[model samples]
Target chain A: MSQELKQTPLHALHAELGAKFVPFAGYDMPVQYPAGILKEHIQTRAGAGLFDVSHMGQVRLTAPGADAALERLVPGDIAALSPGEMRYTMFTNDRGGVLDDLMVTRRAGDIFMVVNAGCKTEDLVLLRAALGDAHVEYDEDRALLALQGPGAAAALARHAPGIAGLGFMKAATVAIGGTEAWVSRSGYTGEDGFEISLPGDAAEAVARLLLGEPEVAAVGLGARDSLRLEAGLCLYGNDLTPDITPIEAGLTWTISKRRREAGGFRGDAIIKAQIADGPSRRRVGIKPAGRAPARAHTAVVGPDGAVVGEITSGGFGPSVDGPVAMGYVTRGCAKAGTEIELDIRGKRHAAAVVKLPFTPHRYAK
Target chain B: MSDVRFTKDHEWVRLEGDTATIGISEYAQEQLGDVVFIELPTVGADVEAGGDAAVVESVKAASEVYSPVSGRIIEVNDDLEATPGLVNESAEDEGWFWRMELSDPDELEELMTAKDYKAFLEGLD
Candidate 1:
């Protein structure tokens, strides 16, 4: 027997907008709207685009020792985090592999965490085992929404004035449409914007209010992919995974110096060794030579027919107007401008390893 | 009169005289979503029936374009490179992938006719 899937607050609204709904992360999600992926991507880059990310898991960690309890799971220096500041961190398994990546914010002695929907169940179980005395509460009734793009700040400022003052990687509790919400000055898209966490019941009302702004347009997962691709942000399942380390995924910067030396979190020994010795394979950018797009699992080969690596994420980047991809290549060949070959359909297509991301990220600082 | 035939892989070929123009069916395009990139075979290339001849990529997924019949590629629609969405806009007509000079017309017998293809699509659902 199978359980019925969950629905986001915007499921009915997505239907009314004629969005193409698909199953994702145990919930029915909108993949694209009638305006389509290309237009939606370009629109978000130009103006404000709204996303219903309610499928993400929102949780609160409490008790006097909540901060210390979380530090046992993640590699970040959580105890050092200032109030209102949010940090991107990851949970590691005993083998030093990434269990999940998440955002944790210090909120009035307690900690607020938001993690991937797919990893929430396992994350909670792991947290319980590690911090048996701590209070771990999952707010399943809360909904997450992202209002992103260059115009996002202005549009959101109309409803929540203080949100405009929050810098990137910051969080604040604000009032929007007479309802309370936790707004964070952070986004998956490299754009400067806010992610609002509100009551599930009022999420639709908040979404409608944001969309009423002429500059704000509804964006789906389709556009979200392109935007994050252009931003060089990692998609959890594709770019970062339980088997992949943050260092190998070109995310070494996310690991702090204090955590790297102290080494208290799970998998710290193996992860610290990887940091010291460097990963054998490194993620690099691939620009296809021709019109054909290089897709995931396509072999990345050297000149002498030696398989160097395999593509993890590949697509036609609307912003760059060509085919771009990212894959793990041998560390020596991962340098920018190293010409490689992509085995796309049995024939070798010319490709070159370059610095990611394929497109320049424009985040309003 | 032209006979419309389809392959199980979703490619449709319209045969007129000895020339067969091939493209994916409208239903195929709908399933694939908006096409972002189309890899067309170069003219004068030899292609075998049931062989991989091209690649079609949408924002969501990528699919191989299989040849419905064996032939030499005579012409390909260059417009698809600039506007791949044409495959979704008008898959059967303006979005036709290429025209080939048939190496063996007998291969058409293995393909499904319009009535058979309509039934094939129905069984798929």
Candidate 2:
């Protein structure tokens, strides 16, 4: 029954704005608005676009030595993160497979995390088991919203003063609409943006305050998927499944040099070995010839017609005015300009490996 | 006015003389959101009722448009290759998928008229 689907705090607001709802991650989330995915994606690239990401889980850890404890679960140098700094890392299994990808921010004595919605249940369980129930406090009463694009910083600064001072990957608490929110200068769209974590009751008001800006528009999940795909960012479940490791996903750079030698996190042995010897398969950017987009699970083939990998995320990129995709390819065929083919409905279409960020990233450094 | 009919699959056909103009209904376009690319069926090819006649790709996923009646494709819309959003903006008129020579006008009896289609959509919800 549709009643079983959970609604976010901004659900009524989305419906009022003519959003079409779809079942996603146990939530009745907006897939697109009357402006459509293409327009929303373009609006985000040019101006600012608001996205309600409240379905994602926000977890806080501050009992004691939480950052060090989190290092036991991920390979990133968590201990090195200074206050207000953020890092993108993944939870790995003993087999070196990525459990989930998350953003870790060092707050005043606590560690804040944002994880994928679908993995929240398991991620919370894992965190509590490792960090203890007293330390892992799930902020279930909060909402997460992302404001992205070239004009995002200026538009957001209107409500939250001093937001423009925040650099990329920086985090700080700011007040908006008489409510405090954890604002982070980071987003998955490769645009300068902020991910705001605020109380649920104040979500609609804060969202309205931002939307009042002429340059801001309400974007839905459909544009979010296309924007991230064009930005060459990985999506969990589609791109970073439990069977795929960080190394195979070509996220080795996320594992800093200091963390490699310390090596106390889960799958440290396997991940470090891949860093030194290189993984047999590597995630690479794919540009299919023509306009036909290759979706997830599309078989990737080498010039010899041998199956090399499968596309994990793909769709029409409104910014590039074409299709873009990401998938794991054999190390031999992972180089840029390597000829490849995509098997769609028993027919093969021409494609090639290309450098990532199909559209240039507009993040403010 | 030409006789117009709609299929349960959300496609519409209009008969003017021996030629039948085909396109998806507005209801179908709304479900599809923004169409990024459309593969029009080959001109001069024979198609049967309910057969997959064309491909419509939106930003997130793809859907198939079926031929509502048996016919021979006479002309495919070339404009869609450049601007597929016409389907979303005007799926009934300017966004017509193709024109075909009707092979069986009797097949129209199996479809729903404008009044019947409106009631059909109402019953769906």
Candidate 3:
């Protein structure tokens, strides 16, 4: 095993809390705390849970015409994104395939972006190589922490007043516990929450303060996976790979009407055709019949025992009280009520296509 | 009740005349985390020693529970249907998975005694 795993700003804190540390996205992250996965999942749903996501990359794109330069990569209407608002968008390859899905926010000062931890290095290299001279800055010394659940709003209000009034998808530069932070009302868990981006030096102090609260607990990567799976969010390597297109990932709404009409982004020609004519395969949600959870790479079988599709993500959803899965199926079989079978270890398990997320999102409007 | 024996794969068998009770060892349940599902063999089904006889799924991973000694499955612990966590809570006692009639009493020689199994566990770490 390679002992050269990357460390987060709160690596010591995780160890102090007796967390089961594991390597994730190049960083040595906590897989679970002593509270266990079940308790952590329930705690995040009921109260507030803090997560250290400092490994995710933060970059700014600045050029003579940055909007036009940035539009060359993604299909979303980036120029139209208002100040203090964040948009979820994807970067595409030349073949209309999604390289990665990321959050882009136009700050009062600059055009800030947050990409997946695993793809951040590649994204930076690609962005810089594509722009040539477009002054792009990678803020590698910044740390991100998410305070999520129903109690998140109240928790933020105590430290940073007026943040409670911020609506979903809104971003504001605020001082959290006297530390300068960019607090955005965005999360991957499909819950009401805020992600605080602060200086790496000040991250430990803020995380420690949050952990002192009775309503707040430190959650780990294990519960994070389960929560995002229940929310129908896409994991970069699994759901949004180089071979999968945004259209097939069931993320058509992220593409704006203006961008759809005037194609200027990379792979626009293929993506536009996919939006109009539909992709060969479509992502669909699956509900398994038995307790056996359909895991990733499980083959999807058609009526006559022929392989039709493959599961990208699947697990026992803690909130759904049963097993749920997401996979790519033939276009016609992506309907919400279509019947399918998942071959788990040669046994075909009955399943039905359903609309994600497996659990309803409770974002604050 | 006859003396119990264990396998390196973490299976335990307690012999009672021709019938024997089988379950996963306490250490196996702990390593698997929380038990989510238990797929038991049907009663009266014949199974071979060291053969795959059951499936045990935890929240983290899935494992196969092999028959320590060949036998005919007499009965399954149906409580696992509604309460799979019982295996985690009581791996060696009330959570016994199945009872079976021994196919060959001599096959029990392949299993390790409790004292020997404890020494094996220490060597593993």
* Best DockQ among the predictions, by candidate number: 2
The regions of model 1 sitting more than 4 angstroms off are A1-3, A303-305, B7-9, B42-51, B70-72, B103-125
Instruction: Give the DockQ ranking, best first.
Output: 2, 1, 3
Against the native chain B, each candidate's TM-score is 0.97, 0.97, 0.97
Candidate 1 Cα deviation (angstroms), residue A189: 1.3
Per-candidate TM-scores read 0.93, 0.97, 0.92
Please give, for residues A1-365, the per-residue lDDT of candidate 2 as tens digits: 55599999999999999999999999999999999999999999999999999999999997778988899999988999999999999999998999999999999979999999999999999999998898899998899999999888888888889585899999998987578999999998999999999999999999999999999999999999999999999999999987898999988889999899889998899988998999999999999998888889999999887999999998899989888999999999999999999997667989999999898888887
Q: What does candidate 1's lDDT look like per residue over A121-190, in tens digits?
A: 9988987777663588889999999998889989998988877668888899999989899989888877
Q: Just chain B of model 1: what TM-score?
A: 0.97
Question: Which docking class does model 3 fall in?
Answer: acceptable
DockQ-wise, the better of 1 and 3 is 1
- Candidate 3 residue A117 Cα shift, in angstroms, is 2.1
DockQ of the two-chain complex in candidate 2: 0.81
